[model samples]
Target: MTDHTINKAVLRRLLSYALDDPKKLGYAILLLLVASLADVSGPWLIQHFIDHYIARDQYPLDMVAGLALAYVALMLTAAWFRYKQSLQFNQIAISVVQRVRKQLFERMINQPLSAFDYMPTGKLVSRITNDTESIKDFYVFVIGTVLKNVVLIAVMLVVMCLLSPRLAAVVAVLLPVVMAIMVIYQRKSADAYRTMRDLLADINASMSESIQGMSLIQLMRQEQAFSQQFSVLTRRHLASQIGVMKLNGLLLRPLIDFLSGVALLSLVALFGVSGTELIGVGVLYAFISYLGRVTEPLIELTQQLSLLQQAMVASERIFGFIDARQQAYGDDTRPLASGQLACRNVSFSYDGQQSVLDGIDVELPHRGFLALVGHTGSGKSTLASLMMGFYPLTEGELTLDGRPLASLAQSVLREGIAMVQQDPHVLSDTVRENVRLGRAVSDDDIWQALEKVGLAGQIRLYDAGLDTRLGSGEANLSAGQKQLLALARVLVARPKILILDEATANIDSGTEHQIQQALQILRQDMSIVVIAHRLSTIIEADEILVLSRGQIIERGNHPQLLTQQGHYWQMYQLQQAGEHLHKLEESAGVPEAS
Candidate 1:
């Protein structure tokens, strides 16, 4: 969503999301209002005791005792109400935040691959974590405080008017003027906060990229370059925060001075005009107390206005995500059949300008094996993405068992297809838990998959067996070992269609042999689609598709393609020559691709 759209829809929905919790929210508001009411009566009690009991030179013991008891009872009740409200609001606010966070996370988790392509991971992280916390500030601090001050303001106004309407009139007029200033400041603050959030995300993205590329940076002796870039971003972030702080400072001091000056002026005017003893010392005392209480709301409103402005910016970000076309909703009308896949004039594009797969047509019957061989940037991975429905086809159709893949629900589509990415992601969990992925898999099934991947013996050799935790990035394992673990994860899923993107490319020959054995075991049940750079690996495929640029240049069995002397043939010959030259180099004390 655009920035304008984010502000409009996101802000509205955030308020609604907050209001959804009504029971505890209602009790909390009621308690806060009651506490304010009781506090408001304090000034009146002082006025009554002073005028009728003390200043009248008639200090009756019973009257004094009654007033004292009443004051104590009100204070006690107010204290209890305040306590209850604080607890209730705190709990309710936390729950509301968690609920909104859960919904936001679900939206992101289920988002299509296209979403990730457009939005940066760092920015998305900021929205889910940082933006949600800003909303919490609105809930836990801003909302309750705003309400309490407003009620106190209202009650104080009533009491002030009862004492003298002229003073009350001055106060009421001053409030609107204060509100006007707050509104103007709030708009400016919101804009500043929004810009600050976006800038912060950019800084975070830059830092994250730099850290991930530290090895490359070191290799190129570009550490100074990266450090200078980071320093510039750091300065930008600090400047944005300073701007917000300055805006807040400017608003607070002026509002306080203005409101305090107005109160002082109104008191002076009221004192000067009074003729009767009606507005005497006691009345003046209570008026001063109420006047002080009156400014509490104005001050609170000003402060909350600033926080709410920041929250509005956060809400805009959060709501934009929630309201974004929720990927593409799945069609749950039918279940997936077999794993047969067919593409007819299918085309997809990351950018609208260049198609990743243009006018591609192919057929893979159920339980049939196919290998996609192409030079880098020949839409191999893009084809895998399309097959998995991670990206919707921009034109034409892809079908599974004569049913349009788009028509199948996400759950069903996923149930039918599984992919082992080129660089498989291993979570920070135990080896077994990573494989199960929170699913309740039988021990027998786990062992079967492990054994099929030829990792069962390796797992048994480890001290913790299946329960062994894979350290961060699986840092404890060799690259080949990590690849075997990734294959085991895929094997555990036992999917109908398995797409391996250079699954064994990083593994040693010994590990590759194990993987080959696993594939031989898996081929009977699962249809395998492989995107391989190593032509020798896919030499036994039922059919091979050679892609150039974005279109398929050739498709045939290995022997048939070799006779054609086309792109596939050319790539094979290059591999052959490279292997022969490598063997020669190896005899002369260099490594070779054996």
Candidate 2:
């Protein structure tokens, strides 16, 4: 929504963040009011000195000195209050922003996996950091400065009306025109600010994407292409910012100055035509001073209005993200009895156009091992994700231990099941921490888990063993090492059920052998579902499902599937042929042409 139609609920919520610490806010308000009063007293004191002391020729040395001293004291008092007001206002604003950022981060992390599929990580980061920072300006500058200016304007108007009602009427007439300008500015700037925010998000997304794929870009020799793409986004962002700057420059201070000049000229003409008796010198001087003070606040308010508009746009985006419906699961605290998983006539579609998995029926008893073999786009990974509670089923039902999976609590599902992906992320932490994953696990358990994955000996060779620090993407480890590390992580969890989605696809034969051995130990007690592209790995599975275009074309043990001479048999024969060709070339000592 635009700033003009700022949702009351959102504004109220934003205000509530500041009001959370009412004492600090109250102290800031009090200081602001005192500072404004002190500011207003300046014109009154000047008028008093002009009318009673200077104009009346009653300048006594001691009296003049005391008046000057009192004026200086008032100025110093105003400065002190203004300084304290700034500190308190900043404190309140910063606190509110901190709370908002924390809540946004918490909400983001708790979001379902599906949300990350569409939302850009960089854009999310921008909303948490940049957008919230804009809201900080709303609290620190807009709210505090606007309130103080309003008070100052009110006091000045009251004194102006008392001094000369006619001049006050002129100001009143011009006030609406100034407000009209502010309204126009707000409307025009709102769109500009929103554009700027969107462009910034785009830039962040582009930069993050580039950084993440830097290695790929370099490998492909496409650095220049990526640079151009990033440059385009940055240029667009810069252009958006320039548009906002131009709008602010034309509308904010310049318009206020023009309006102030008009008011001053009007005052001069009124006084010129009228005599001293009608508008005294002291009154004229005070009116001129009050007019300047009035316009200063108007200028500040106009500038803050721009910031407020930006903040409103940011709040809308943030609130939109916060308002997304989280995935629904039961709050049942009961532990899962067994990991027996079953899917009955489960049909699924990502976009509701074409089905990815159709009329699928499968069951795995506790401690059983089922392997899903499929070509790419055969819905093998999708089925595994469904089993992990990553997405809601589109049709039919998936269950665990005779209970509907959807009805099970997320914690229960997590406790009972774990999945190791094809390309698992290795956290930038010590090996122990990575495996423990913040759980209260002992070093012995960590070592045992590593040993199970055949990584203990390799880890022990490092200077710090399990305590060695790993870089992001596990730069210190090979693809097989990272995969083994991920396996170690799951082993430590000791899940009742495990799904490995091509977990050994990239590992060497030796590392694959190590993983297969670990799986043998795991399958003794836990139900294992393995999604594999490699046919050799699943030869020993109790049952293997050959998925073709989302349907199971063949379901049997390796020998049974081979006897059928179906899709599974053809795939196995082709893979064996490809391996034999590679071995023949290696034995002949021939370097195959790229």
Candidate 3:
């Protein structure tokens, strides 16, 4: 029952999309009605040509020629009308798909980061691209096929009645049988199509994961295992596809064709038994022709039942995603006046239990530098996420300048605070566009930002210079270069507060020195927050906080923390020793001086 209601809702939404340009759809339907009328007239014309002249002893060549010409003109007229109607239908379908894809992509991207914690990237992408395409197929194939067949059937039935009411009634009896076949097919195929769509999404998810992690898979020598896993998924998908085909074979073409034969047989038997003076040869001929035409539509309509099922399931999935949690943000749009930030008794949890951060309070003045250090799972990244407004705090106040962080508009906060992640995503767009990020910044500003990050010279060597596009395999830049590009992206914004989540971890020492120098210059104006796995990077910070199990255990400058010999001291000593060992290994890795 719920599925029925959801299907109804999906149909209504599709109807709304079709109705977006009502004038085009209305004209198309009108043309289709005309085409159906013309189509029905063909058999009547043939009946007239047969009984009026050919059956008679007199065959006037002019009249026969006239009938032939009329037949040709009628065929041409129907073809033209159908062609125009199909064009309109296609246009509307494409437009609807474009609009739906835009809305769907907007919804997908606007979701909170936390919402994606449980959702796979590929599954969401499939919803936006693949599922939306299923909707387009409904409009393009199912709607057009069903509407044309229905109009043809309706017109044929009316002509059948015009010829002989009794024979029309016989044909009408077959309507209920066609409907029964349709109902049975729908019942059997609904779950099948739903399963197919899910399996397709799973297949897409698996492919995306494999592609993204192919290097790791190869390095780990798990290629054969991954292939076997993919084979299993594909086999399941194939089984589902074959199941649908079996349904199509059983209930759609073959059974409907058999039913057509049964209808013809029934009509012929009834006509012979009731050999009355009420109907003539012409009438019988027209009835037979109409019966043939009507069954074709019944067959077509039954075939489209599977498509209708697939579209409804796709719609349900799409609406489900759109209705899920959207990132809740405040409407406050006020601009920042200071770089001051403070966290007062802040606590947070992902599942509303077992807090990840608890009772953490800290403050940073304008132009101050603060660093957070911890082992894995110590909430360092979570706190950074909060500072960047990626997720709302679970408890306590995180304020920017003097205002509550959550109350500030995302745009305002984003413009006032910038973060460059360790491995930032570069769009498959030009370098200038990447740095400018759709902002109103000039190319000069982009170049200046790049220059500050010490990547200006390296980027200039590209053939397209600022216009060079980058993504996945197209990016010729190294990992360290991409980090600099990210820093350059943020530098163009010149935010008041900068959060660096180990942004320097991937860079070599020379580039890291350049970035550190850039950060030092920016520290004269902007307050900076750094989350570091490398202890040496934060040794010169104004203050450093050492965290464990969601609470700060030590807070001080580097020298002060060393004196305390606490978690910070232990971590720094370990990193220093590791670096020393790495240098020795590097020395041993090469032959002595020569």
As for candidate 3, its clashing pairs are: none
- The Cα RMSD of model 1 versus the native structure comes to 2.7
Runs in model 1 deviating more than 4 A are: 1-12, 329-337, 473-475, 585-594
TM-score of each: 0.93, 0.96, 0.95
Across 1-594, the per-residue lDDT of candidate 2 in tens digits comes to 744555667778789887878888898989988998888888888888888888889989988898788888889989999999999999888888988888888888777888898778789989998899988999988998898899889888998998899989988776788889888887787777788889889888888887988899999999999889888878887888899889889988888798889989999999999977788899899999999899988888888887888788899889888888787788776777777999999988887888999988998999888999989999999999999988889999999887898888988988889998988887789988888899889999999999988889988988888888888543388777888888888898888899999988888788788788888888887899999888888888989998988999889999999999989999999999999999999999999888
In every candidate, how many clashes are there? 0, 0, 0
Badly placed stretches (over 4 Å) of model 3 are 1-6, 471-475, 582-594
Top TM-score hit: 2
On a 0 to 1 TM-score scale, where does candidate 2 land against the true structure?
0.96
Sort by TM-score, best first.
2, 3, 1
Task: Please list the residue runs of candidate 2 whose C-alpha ends up more than 4 Å from where it truly belongs after superposition.
Answer: 2-5, 472-475, 590-594
Q: Which scores better on lDDT, 1 or 2?
A: 2
